[model samples]
Target: MKSTTLSRALLASSIALALAGCNSSNSNDGGGHTLPLEECKTYQSAPEVIVLSDNENIERQTITIGATGDMHGRIFAYDYALDSVDVNAGFTKISTLLSEERAQNPNMIMIDLGDTLQGNSAELFNDLPVHPVVDTMNFMDYDLWVPGNHEFDFERSFLDKNIQAFEQAVISSNIVWDKNSDACATNGEEVPFLPSYQIFEIDGAKVAVVGLTPSWVTNWQASSPQNFRNLDFKNELESVRKAVEDATAKHQPDVVIGALHWGRKDGGTGVHKIATELADYFDVLFMGHEHAQFIERVEKDGDYTADQLNISVRDADGRPQNQVEDKNISERYHSANRHESVKVIEPGSWGWALAKAEIELYKDADGKWQIFDTTLANRTVADIEEDAALQQEMQEIHDASVIDANTQIGTVDGNFTFTGHVSKFGGDEAVHEDPQFDGATNRLYTTIHHAKVADMPLVDFINQTQIRVIEEKATDHNGNPVKVDVSAAALFGDSSNLTDGQVYLKKDSANLYMYDNMLVATEISGEQLQNFMEWSYSYFNTYQEGDITVSFNKDIRAYNYDLFDGQGFTYEVDIAQEPGNRVTITSIRGTEFDKDATYVIAVNDYRFSSTMVPNGWVSEEDELWNSADETVYAIRDMLTEYVAETGTLSAGEFTNQNWHIVQYGQTDAEGNLVGDKGALLKARETEEGSKLWQQLQNKEICVVREESRDSDITIAVNYKDGSTWYENPQPGTYQGCVH
Candidate 1:
C-alpha cells in the first residue's frame, strides 16, 4: 500500500495507559513522484535481506534508520524571508538523501524527531486539511513522529488536527492528559494523548521505539497555557525509563530505541542524562531540538559522566570500526569482555544533515536474534541534489509565500539595523573611494560590540512598538485600561535590518522580529524593575582598572541582554561596578526613584517565561494583559500592522538615547568620560585619531596578538588582508581607544 491513514480513535485507544501516577492537575520534501495529499501512510516495506555472515548457521541482517529533526519548515531550497536561495538546508534536498538510503537499504525506518511544523512560509498552510510539512513527510513515508516543544506554540485544536491527520504514528511518552483537568476529562484517569512507543517487526525481529519530548513546555509556554491545556509534561528520565520497561516487558523486543526531542547537554533534561543513567535500557537513542549533529557511544559499565559521554561524534574515524567481523574474528571479539553500550545520534536541524544508523543483527545458535554491531554517520546536504519531484510538488505554496513576503506593507525612510554600527572615525555617512567598499556602506562601529555601551535605535524601535501596542490594546488584570510604564526588548537577529526608502513587505516584518513571540504586559515594583535591569546589564564582564576594551560575559547569550526604555524611566549601567550593582535608575518620570513604586511593563511572552518568572520578578497571576487575547497576537504581525497602518516608519519616532553605559577608568568619580583615558576614547572624532581608527578597524593596521605594556609592541600593518609590514609603536598612545 502507498500510504493509508490510521483511524484517530483506534490509535488513541492503542496507546499505553499505565502512566496514571504521573498525571497532574495544573492549574519532507518534495516529491519526486506527486502523491495524493489526502492519503497519510508510510511506504516502508520489509527489510531487504543483506546477509553479512558467511557461516551457514548464522543469519545476519542490516537495518538502516534514516531520521530528520528540528526541520523548522524548510521544505524548499528558498528562504521566503530573505527572498534568496538557501543552499544550506532544505527538505527537498534531504529527500534526495532519503531516497538513496531507502534504495540502498529497503529495511530503513524513517522518522522525524519534531519541531517540524513551524518556522518558515510552510506555516501559511497550517489551516489546510493537512499541514504542508506533514503532507510532505507522509509522502516521503516517514514512519514515526515525535511532538516537540515548538509544537505547542499554536492552539490545541491545531495540534489535535495535525496529530490526527498524520498518516503514521505520533509518539511522545512524557506528555499526558492531566486527569484532574476539566478540559480533558478521562473518567478521573490519566491518559496518554498519543502512543508512548511503537513496535515494528522486521524479519521477525521486534524493534520498539519510545518517544520523549521536552518536559519544560509548561514554563516555555506559560503565557499561553491554553495551547497545552489539560496536559502535564512529566519528568523526562522517569517517563523514558518507565516507557522502556513497559515496552520490554510487554513485547520483549530485540532492540529498543529512544526518539528524544531534547538536546544533548544544554537543556536540563537531555540525551546526556539519558546516556549516563539509562544507557542499559536502550540500544540506540536519536535526538533533536538543539539543531546539532553527532553520534556517540556510552558503555554501560563505564565511569563516564554525562559531560564526557555527551560529545557529538562528527568524524567517522572517531567512532569504533568493528562492524560485521568475520566469524572467526567475531568469536575472538565475543570471547573478550565486551560491555553493553548505547549508541546516540542526532541530525542537525533545518534539513542540513541526515542521521543514519545501520544496525547489524544476527541469529545466534539459540535461534534468538541479537544485535552484533552498528555504524552511525550524519550525511550533510551541502552538495546533495534537490529531488526535482519534490520541488515540482511544492512549487505553488513556495511561490505564494515568496509573493507574500515581497508584497508591500508600508515604507521606511531609513534603515533600522541590528548589525550595522556607525564608525566614529569614518563618520556615519562617510563613503570610501576603494573598490572593495562599493556597496552603500557607512559604519564607524558595530552596535553589537557597543550595544553594552550605548542605546540602539534598532532595540528602541522594538521596545517603542511593544509599548505602543500594549498601551493601545492591553488591559489590567481587572480589565481596566492600563498605561505602559516601561518597555524592554532584545536584538535577536544579527543581520536583520530595514532598508532606506524601501517598500516594507511582510518579510521585512519577519526579518526584523525573527521570532513568534506574543506581546505581554506585567505589573512589577520599582525594586523588581531595578533587579531586572541589573540582571540585563550583567551581560557585561567586570571592567578592570587598566582594561582598554570592554568585554562581554561569554556565558550569557546576546538575546538575554535586553534594552529597557520608557517615558517613565531612565537608567545607567556602570560597568565600573560589579554585576549585581551595575544598574542605577537615574530618573523615574523626572521624579526620585522609588523602589516601592508599582509600574506596568511590556515584554515578549518568551521574556516573561524565560526570565521574569524564573527570577520571581513576575508571576502568571501578575499578567496585566497578553496578546494571546487579541486578534493580532504575534509580535511580528503586530509590527507589520503598525507599519502598514502608519504608511511610513520614521527613525526619529523610535530613537531614544535613554540608557547608556558608564566606563571605569575613563570616567570621573561621578561616572563621566572626562579623564585622560576618556580623552583617548573621544579622540576618534579628531583628524589623526579618525585616520588611525579607520585603518585599525579595517585591518589596514593591526596589533600583535601577544602584546604587553612591559614589552615592545609589534604593530603589523595590513596584518590580516595584505603583505605584513611591521612598525615599533608607542605603547600608551593607543591605550583605551575604542575601535
Candidate 2:
C-alpha cells in the first residue's frame, strides 16, 4: 500500500527531474523557466566533497542531504530595509552552494526547514502570481518544504498561494484542518492541512522525511488568528511521533529524518526532547526557528553533546569536538547510550549556512539496506558568491523592494535612542545635552545606558504610539468610549535608533517596531501593574555592593523586557532590590498610588495572550479592545501612520519621562539614598555642585569599582586630566573623595 502511494510520487518527481535536465541542458533547474547558463557558468565553483566514513565496500551507498531554514525571505544578497548589499548572507548565495553540491552528487536531497516567506523583501511580492522566494526554491529544485511559525505571519491567502506554487512536496504532520470549525469543515472527515510526510527512493533505499511545525504559533499570532484561519497546530511531539511510526510501519525507510521547524530547546517540543523520547524512530533531525547554527548528537537516554564542525573540524572518534559557547549551546553529558545516538543539525538563519547531513548505507546480513553512519556539517555560504543567474532573475524584485524601503516617511530633529554614557548618577550636570531634559517631571535623558536599564525616548515612542491608537479607536466591553491611562511596550531591536536631522524612511520605522503585533487595551489593578513592571524589570541583574556596571540577566530575552509610559504616572526600579521587589510607583496622575485602584492599560496582543491572560493577571473576558478590529491592525503600521500624521518627529511628543532606574551603595536610616552613587542621583533636583556629573556625562571621567587596602569596596573615578578620586564609603562612615 505504501509503495503504491509513495512510489508514484517519487516516479513523478524523477520524470520531472529528467525533463528539467533536458530543458536546461547544463543544469537541472526544476522550474519551467529556462536557466541563464552562460551568465552562471563563470561564477560556478567546484564543490568540496569530504568522505565521512573510511570505507572501501563496493556494496556501500551514500546520500547527501542539504537543509536550510529561518531564511526569513532573504532571497538575494541585499538588505532592502537597510538599502545595502549584504555580502555575507542570502538564498542566492545558498543557491550557488546548492548547484555546486548537486553537481558533485545528484543523489542529494534538498529540504527547506521553513520561515521562508516573511522578512527581508519577500512581502513586496506577496500579491504576485508567484512569490520570488518560492520561485527561487523551485529553480533550485528543493525536495521537501516545511512550514515555520513566521510563514503564517501574513494573510492566509498569501500563505495558501505560496504553498500551492511550490513545485515539491510541502509537508507538515502537526498542522491539521479544524474539522469542527465551519471554515475547514470536511463533513466529519479528519484531514491534515498538508501531507504528513514524503518518502523518496534514493540509491534503491527508501528515505522518509517527516515535517513538524511549532505548536506555539497560536500564542505568537494570537492577535491575528485569521492568518492561520481554520488550521490547528497540534502538539509537536505526538504528531511527529505518529507520522514517523506510520511511515516506518508501512515504508520501513532506511533512514527516517525529522524536518523539525523548531529550535533544539524550544520549551517541551524541542528537538533534544524529541530525539531522546523518539530516538529509535529517527535517524537524523534537521532543525530551525532559533536562527542559530550547531550539530548536536543526543543519546537515547537524553545525554547531549554537540559537534560543531565549523569551529574546529577535528573528528572525535566519529563525532566532531568543540566547547559550547555562552550563546545557548548544549550541556555536556558524561553518560553514554548503548544504542546508536540521534544526530541533529541546524543552519543559522538568513542563508548564512547550509545544514548538511551525509548518510552512508550498507546491506546488512538480512540483505536489507541499513544506515551505516551519518556525519553532519553546517556549510557556510559567506565565501560563496551569489549565483549570477539567480541575481539577474531577481534584479527587478530587488530594485522595487529597495525603492519602497527607502521612501522617506518623515524627519527627526534629534536622536530618539540613548547614545551617551549611562552613569548611576542622575544629577543635573549629567542630564542630556538636549535643553529640554528634565528629571522631576520625568522629561529627561541623562546618560546613554537608559534603554534597558532605564526608560528612554526609543521605548517611549512605541508606548505613546500604542496608547494614542488605542485611545482614538478602542471602546470598553459595553461599547462605551475608553480612556487609556498607561501603555507598555518592549524594545524589539537593539540597533533601532534614528539619527538627528535625518530623513526617516520606511525601513527606519520597521527597525523601530520589528514585529506585526496588534494593540490591545485591558483593565488591571494597580497591584497587577506593579507586578507586571517587576516581572519586566527582572531582566536586570541585581546590583551588588561592589558592582559598578549594571547588567542584564542572560536567561531572559530582550523582547520580554517591557517598559511603560502613562498619561500621568512616575515609577522607579531599584536594582539594589530583588527581582520581585524592584518596582515602586511613586505617583499616578500627580497623586500617590493606591494598589487597589483599577487602571486601563494598552499593550500588544502578544503580551495580552502570552503573559497577562495566562498568568491570571487579567481576564480575557474583560478585554477592552483589539486593534485588529480597526483599519490599522499592526503596531508597525500605526507607527508609520502616527509619524505620517504628525509630519515631524520630536522627543517632546513621545517621551513621557515616567520611569527611572536607580542603584544605590548606601541608604540612610529612613531608607533614603545617601551620598555614594545615590547622592549623585538626588543632586539632580538641586542642580548645584554638579561638576562631577558634568564630567561623567561628557565622557571626560570614568568610574571603576575595586578593592581597598583593607579589602573593602572602593569607588574610584579616573579623570581625563590624570586625576584620581577614590572613596571607600561604608555604612555611617562616609569617606568623601576629592580630585
Residues 1-739 of candidate 2 have per-residue lDDT tens digits of 0011112343344334322211111111123322222210111111111123333344667788899998887888776655666665688889888887888878688999999987774654554545668877877778779989888776566666667677778888888777777765577766777767888776467778899888888776766677777777888888988999888888888788889998766756677878888887787789888776666667675543342222224334332322121212332211122134566777777886888877777787766776655666777765578988878766656666666677677898655644334323222223333212111011122212335554557778888888777777877867888887788888765445665677877777776776767788989998898888889988766664333335456456567878888877778778778899988888876788888999888999889878887777888865788876565577877887777777788855665567666653233222233455553244432333255545454444443322111111133232222333323232111121111
All candidates' lDDT scores? Answer: 0.65, 0.65
TM-score attained by model 1: 0.78
Lowest-sum lDDT 10-residue window in model 1: 17-26
**Candidate 1 C-alpha lDDT tens digits along 373-423:** 656667777667788887766665566677667778788865443223332
Question: Model 2 — TM-score against the truth?
Answer: 0.76
Which portions of model 1 show Cα errors greater than 4 Å? 1-58, 183-188, 298-306, 309-341, 417-453, 541-555, 575-578, 664-696, 699-739
Clashes of 1: 11
Which pairs clash in the backbone of model 2? 421-448, 442-657
Supply candidate 1's per-residue lDDT for 467. Answer: 89
Off by over 4 Å in 2: 1-58, 183-189, 303-339, 418-449, 664-739
